[model samples]
Target chain A: MLLKDTISAALEGLKRSRMRSMLTTLGIVIGVGSVVLMVSIGASFERFIVDQVESFSGDTFEIHAKGVQDIGKDVLSITFGDLEAIRGLTTVKNIAPAIFLTDRAKYGREEIAPMILGTTKEIFYNWSMKIDEGRLLSDEDDKGAKSVVVLGSQAAEDLFQNENPLGKRITIGARKFTVVGILETMGSPLTAELDSMVYVPFLVAKAIKGRTTYIDYIALQSINGDNELTRQDIVSLLRQRHNIDNPEDDIDKDDFYARSMEQAMEIIETVTMSITLFLGLIASISLLVGGVGIMNIMLVSVTERTKEIGLRKAVGARRRDILIQFLLEAIVLTLIGGIVGVIGAISFGYLISLIASKFLGDLTYALSVQAIILPLVTAVAIGLIFGIYPARKAAALQPIEAMGYE
Target chain B: MPENDAPLIETKNLQKSYFNEELETPVLFNIDLTIKKNEFVAIMGPSGSGKSTLMHILGFLDHHTGGEYLFQGQLAHEMDEDTLSRIRATRVSFVFQAFNLLPRASVEQNVMLPLIYHPTIPESERAERVAKAIETVGLTHRKNNLSNQLSGGEKQRTAIARALVTEPDIIFADEPTGNLDSVSGIQVMSALQELNEAGHTIILVTHEKSTAEHAERIIELFDGRITKDTTEFKTRKAKEEDSLQK
Candidate 1:
């Protein structure tokens, strides 16, 4: 028989049982939909986190002391002398020694817990922070260790409540500090809570901690993304200054780490990829069940159309022709399902992206072309594989025996 | 009728039996028959006389358990399923008692079914043959109507047209008018008779005496065996001999 004839006959058979065909297709739709949605959300999640980290800063490195809480740990702390030494390197654009102190601030009747960071004025160029009003801590404030603070936008609002905080003295742990500047608003990503911080000169913050010798870390910006070269220089200089014997050892072995923004981005990517792969496989199980569902329906179709099969055979349809006709029907059934599933998944992914972007800081969901193509191909394959037994059953029916069936 | 040319269909000691592991029920036993070219014969018997079974065996729709069956002297009993299907497609066609036109297909589509499997004709020629077949059956006005949408007579005629579309040499119509009213019955019988007069050999299986009377010859089956055979219409070979004498 001609391929066109087989297809038309299959179409007629399906049209006679529209409800059953649609129900069988629904299984594949759910299968493909969940897979696409999971992958799209995963890709969008990776993009969101990467974008979030990039928003923090760019082309920078940080030197931090190793954790002493763990066993066999060395308490290698960075010093201000090392920061000054690295600042003169040709690849270094700017450097700032940052120290954090837990402190409470008071303004008239209001009290707010604020994270206080101590750094130089060049810290503004290394981070996203900018002065909205008044002046940042000057070099004079750092040299003299003056009790002056720059309040983060949220912290300023909480302490002063719309009042101009510049030059207002706020007591922090028995020390009165004049607020010299209010930093611009910056919503945090997966990093530091910058909106609720207060900035001070490095010397002043260390003096408040009563540990003027040890600083938390020095933040360094590289000129034209010469970050790796700058990291090598800092490691050599720090190891020499602290007099660690092994120059061949890695920084982590010396209980120190020079971390970059790129490393954090890679960690986020690995995490999202693993999660999406796991979820996508779990979603494919439903398609397997859908294939069996198609087989069951096709078996019933063969039983119901036995008489028609008899008539076709009597009119000279070969067994192969009958098999091809029945097989084409099942394949056509699932192909329709596959197409509908891809459309549903893509549109659903778009909805998820819209909602996530609105509520979750620019998170997006997106369907990849593979997400659509793979499932559609799987649906076709499922039909081809599962359709065989029923098609063979129909083809093997004897014309006289089949005709005798009511 | 007897002729010097080879018979269209011949079966010697044809037998059919239904069997499983426990039992064997014989349906037709040692039936010997021959049908000549352009012969219109009806095999008539009461219910359960194995008339339909004999028709099935003769039509190549069933395999004979014991027989030497031949189609134009080709050994049909030795033919494989593929060869039998090829023969069925080109040399033989059937119009069942139930008017087995595909219920969903229109009259035109039902008529074109045999041609769908007709390999000898070019693809472009099939539609023209189908049109002529439907027009010959006087169903051109209702060609677009579905099979189930037609009356019983129309359905039977459509089946005839479907059988005629490939222009098979032989037509085996198993009770073609069995389900129709008397007027519709005569109409369907006349259609088969018209095809017979056009030099197409037709074999019919029926129990109705009035339906059997339309055939040029009758073969009576009783208890799975032929009891009598008679011819009412004058054999064409006899008329040709008379013409030659003139």
Candidate 2:
């Protein structure tokens, strides 16, 4: 029989039982929709994390006390000595040692807890930090030992009540420091709480707290070319200075740990992407169930249309022709469902991103091609895998017995 | 017609049996028969007498358990399933007692089915043949009507049109008018008779004496064996002329 005639006849069969066909297709729709939406959400979350990581300076790395009990514990053992030794290396462009102290600050009795960070002037350049108002801490300020502070945007708002806070005095654990600059909003970091912090000169902060041989963390930048080599050099130099054989072993010792931002980003990306794909794979179970649904319905359809099969066979339809007709119906049904699910997922992703950005301040919604194509191709494959048995069964039916079936 | 030449349909020592697991019940005994080109014949028997079974074997819808069956000198047993289907499509057509029209199909589409199976006919010419078949069956006014909407005789006529559209060498009618009233039965028999007289060979299986009376020859079967084969004595010339007028 002609292909057009066969297809038209199949369509006629579907039309004759419209409600049944629609119900069968609805199972596929839900199956495809759930899979696509789940993967889209997972992908969006991964993009959110990647965007947060990329917001940091890609060329920088962080150094902290190895074997530190906790990141919040007294890791002040890293001092200017380590920073100077790191700077002596040929591949080291700039190094900044950071000391963090938490204290209550009062501005007209609006008291709030905020972090106070003490670092050199070069930290602004190395870390890509921006100042929204006034000026950043200058090298002259670091050299002359001035008592000046930079307020994070949130801290500035909390203390100054929308007034320009630059040049204003803010008390930090009893010593008053002048607000030399107000830092721009950095939004939320993937791993840090940066909104409620204050920055001050390293020497001044040490003097105010009477601290010696203590530093919180250090930021390092490499000179042009071979960042891996530079990172190795810095690690070796720190290891030698701290008298540690293995940096990993130093995690329990009072040694120092150094790592490039690229390494950290790679680790973070691997973890986040693994999580996304894990969730995507979990959602694929539903897609598999949807495929089985197609198979089940097709089997039922083959049974219900036994008489039709008999008629076609009686009219000289080949087994392959019967097989192809049923297979094509299944594939077409799934592919159409896949398309609808994709469209739904894209629109839903957009809606979610719009809502997220409103609360999260311009976070981008990622549209991954794999997220779209994987589910569609998976749906088609599911149809084929599940459709084969029913097609074969229909094809194998004897013309005499099938015609005799009620 | 000389018996030496190849008949349109021929069977030798044809035997068919049904196995119900315990016993082999033979439905067609060791029978031999020959149908010439364009001869209108009917096989008559009561229910379970093997007339329908013989029609199925003749139409190539079923295989004989032990037999030498030939269509236009080609051995039936040697043909594969695909080849048998091709023969059914191009060389023979069937009209069932229930009219077995695809109920969802329109009258014209039902008539067009057999031509659809004929690979030699161009699609354009198939449409022309379908139109001509429907016209010959006197269903031109109902060409667009679904088979379910057709009356008993109209449905049977549609079946006849479908059988005729392929322009096959023979038409197998297994009680084509079994479900119709006397008037509808007469109308269907007249259509079949006309087709036969127009040089299409027809082999009908019927229990109704009146329906078999319309044919030029009647072969009687009893208990899976042929009992009588004879030419019609009464109304022979009138029936022949009626068949010829079409």
How large a fraction of the reference contact set does each model reproduce? Answer: 0.61, 0.43
Misplaced by over 4 Å in model 1 are A56-97, A120-148, A160-171, A178-184, A188-192, A212-259, B1-6, B77-81, B120-123, B227-246
lDDT of 1 by residue, B77-193 (tens): 778888877777888899999987786789998888877776677779988998999999899999999888999999999999999888888899998988989898888887888
lDDT at A303 for candidate 2?
A: 94
Give me the TM-scores for chain A across all models, comma-separated: 0.84, 0.92
- Candidate achieving the largest DockQ: 1
lDDT of 1 by residue, A98-190 (tens): 777777889999999887888888777667578899987788999999999998888999999979999999988798999999988766455
Docking class of 1: medium
Clashes of each: 0, 3
Give the C-alpha miss distance for residue A202 in model 1, angstroms.
2.7
- Cα-based RMSD of the predictions, in order? 5.0, 3.2
Best by TM-score: 2
- Residues B1-246, candidate 2, lDDT per residue (tens digit)? 123467788889989998897799889998898889988899999999999989988887778899789877778899898897788778788888877777677998788877766767888898789899999989899999999999999999999998999888889999998999999998999899889878899898999898898887899999999999987533445655778997
